[model samples]
Target: MCGIIGYVGADGALPIVATGLKNLEYRGYDSAGIALNNGTVDVFKQSGEIDDLTLPAEHSATCGIGHTRWSTHGQPTDANAHPHTDESGDVAVVHNGIIDNYESLKSELSSHTFTSETDTEVIPHLVEEHLSDGDDLLSAVEATIERLEGSFAIAVTTSGQDGFVVARQDSPLVLGHGEDGNFVASDVTAFLEHTREVSYLEDGDVALVTGADVTVYHDGGTVDRPVQTVDWEADAAEKGGYDHYMLKEIHEQPQALRQTLSGRLDTVTGDVDLELDLPEQYLNSLEEIQVVACGTSNHAGQYAARLLEQFADVRTTVEVASEYEFRGGRDPWRTLVVAVTQSGETADTLSAMRRAASAGARTLAVTNVVGSTAAREADDVVYIRAGPEIGVAATKTFAAQVATLTMLTVYVGRQRGALSGDRASTLLENLRRLPGAIQQVLDEEDATREVAYDLIDSDGFFFVGRHLGWPVAMEGALKLKEISYINAEGFAAGELKHGTLALVTEDTPVLAVLTDGAKPDQTLNNVKEVESRGAPVIGVSSLDDTTKYLDVEFAVPDLGTLEPLVANVFLQLFAYHVADALGRSIDKPRNLAKSVTVE
Candidate 1:
């Protein structure tokens, strides 16, 4: 996904636009560009990071639009960057999603001269054609959008036009309300430094923004959108004192978990007061639970599925969102399809949720964003109240998702009478102390970092666990490979003899997660198998006895079934330190973006 920002204000637009692009760099982009509208549109572009771009010393333009592009239709080149313009160079457009029918549209406009290899080039030309046919700027943009196909969040500005037009169809776009100016951007972070108030644009909506006002339209009718204030402070997006945002976010997990659990749990009554408006009849429907997610969120879903099945006594299944198909075979009436996502804008997860809805399943979204597509489309929604997570490899949100789902398990168990009062009280009390437990892990970061230093030169890494530890193992492998670029694999301890054992070598460090609920002795036997092959063992456990078998041991707080969650923080630190040592990009890993908005 790319980032787009536009501003119509009295301040120098170029500087503001450039700062916004820098804020969005975590989205992962290869090129950056900006278009300034003074007496005429002046476009500047580069084929590298946003920081590499240079602006004119002084420009009279007070309005402009900018883009940080992740190449899709064309390779990463200056010509392929955004702020594409028409032949006259009067109109400039910065777009975010794909134009699915660009080839046919290009063929239809054979007489037009194209300067760039991008699907976005057709947009400005089409708008120019409409303007030549006696349409105003607003009408031209609206007509151009009608002819285009597929997802897009586009911002268009012309030299002589008094305002800019932005449209959204199946992509994210938000408007910022400011006293000195009006702004449009792909994400709230782009404009958070300028304004906290924003209005989210829905699918098939168009808006025209001027220096002083903003007007929105949906289906040819004028509409008034709600203005919501962002809760995250502007400094929250900044790296306070840490060397990298990834490390800073890793340290923020304890506070994030505390915020997630605050005031929501009633330990006195052992009740979870989620306050979600789902009817009791829907909650009482006894059948099955299906969780759909992608990547790290899918791992969280796997952990939640195990807890839901164990605590709620419900038949639960976890499916990767990209591979889930909701065709007409299964009875969806009694199924609750839970969509788990951090941004809530993942393309695959959104498609999966739509299919589940079409199949008559009761859909619920567990996501972090308040106005995300998944939050708006699902039958019911629960916010994972984990404040903004900026790192490309997720840290805080993963912990928050698992914690929230654990609480959801408690709620379901209460509704189904699966857990008695005393047992529920005990679980709730443990949940209340989870933040302190995780804080204990955070306090032991120096030890984890030391372990990371010890295993920095490992040829490869293998992670193994059982039961709830299995998902923790998977997450640990994912974090290490994503950030450190290490060759790593995670397996159930029992699966080692099947095929994974062959890959174990003396140079490969085997990381074993030995927690309370996961059969510790069985995993210990698996550890022995790897040890016999001369593979070094690094044990992550709360127990003291397991350290005897390990060359190095990382201790986590002993929280019974909750130990796996705390153990994850140590693994996250290990990956961060390893990546930092290797001089890898810890915040923005290569070839990976923060949100998978495109398929």
Candidate 2:
């Protein structure tokens, strides 16, 4: 998917649209383009970043749409960049998400001269044909989407029309109500600097945005979406004195976890009071909990699965959302499917939630967003409460998600009579102290930076752990690969000798998780396997005895099964320092978007 920005207002549109595109740069893109409608449409586009894009020096266009494309239809090329126009250059369209029926539509419009190898080109041409049929730009866009099939959010503008028209279908689109102009974008962050007052657009909804106001249409009738004021400042999305957004978010984990656990826990009764609407009967009757997620969220699910089984006596399975399919043997009435996504709009997770709901299973969304598709569509919702992680590589959200799931585990455990009050109280007390523990890890950033600088020249990296540590290992490796662009892998410690041991070398470094609940003895034995091969070992350990066996050791606070999470902070800092030293784009990694809206 990509970023989209549209504006129709009294002020010049080019500046607003351009700045919006820059704000959305953290989403990751291959090319950038903008289309302005003065009397005739003027398009300026390039195959690289917005910083290098050259536009008109002077233009008075007050209505326009801009795009930062990630190259879904064609390879990154100047001709393939967005603002795809009609043959006569009458209409310009910028789109996010794929068009499934573009090939057929292109074949039907053979007489139309296409300029780009993109499904987006067909939209402007189709809108042009409708405009030729005496339809206004809004009507033309409405008709154009009716003939297409796919997940998309599109912004369209024409030479003859003053305002822009935007439509959403299985994709995210929001409108920003500003005093100077009205804005449309793939997300609220695009226009947050201009106006925090915004409204979300749902599927099958289209809106006409103008200098005066926003008029939303659903199906065929007018609708009013409530405008809410965003609580965060525009500069929250900015890196606050940190080298990169990833580093800033990593340090913010303590506060993020506190926000997630705030006012939801009672150590005395061991109860969690969340907004989840599931009945007490359903909580007790739950035989299995299937978590569907992708990427780092999937790792969070994996980590939470163990807690659920151990604390709640419930069978738990973590499935990658893209490959999720309910087994036929499980009773739908007793099954609860949890969709875990940092961005509630994750395409695969939303689709998996729908699949489970269609099969009569109860659904819950564990997301950071309030009105996200997953939050809206699921039967219940549990927010992680980690605000606005602008880094493409997730840092704070992972910690918050695991913390939230841990609270959910405690709530279910107590509800099902699986855990005693004393046991619950201890966990709650530990949870209360989690923020301070994470801060301890953050305080060791200087040493972690030293170790990272030393390991930057390693041939490869391997992160290994058992049980709870396995998921943390996976997440650590992901951070390294995502930001440092290193060749890294994570696996169960016991499985190392099976085949992975052969890949170890003197130049390679092995980071082992030797935490309390992850069976440190077995992992310690595996650490010896790498040490024998002359590989440097960096240990994230809670046990003092294991530190002697490691070449370098990072101590984590003792939190029983939660030590790996504190250890994760050290890993995040390590990844950040390495990426920073290498001069890699830590906040916006190449070829990766902050949110994957396309499957």
lDDT of each: 0.85, 0.87
Residue pairs with colliding backbones in model 2 are none
Clashes of each: 0, 0
Segments of candidate 2 deviating more than 4 angstroms: 1-237
Write candidate 1's Cα lDDT for 303-372 as tens digits: 8999899888888999999999874566787788999999889999999999999988989999876557
The deviation in Å at residue 345 for candidate 1 is 0.3
lDDT of 2 by residue, 23-109 (tens): 877554568999999878999998888898898877899998999876545556789898898988878899986676788899999
Report the C-alpha displacement of residue 117, candidate 2, in angstroms. 47
Which 10-residue window of candidate 1 scores lowest in summed lDDT?
232-241
lDDT over C-alpha atoms for residue 27 of model 2:
52
TM-score versus the correct structure, for each prediction: 0.63, 0.63
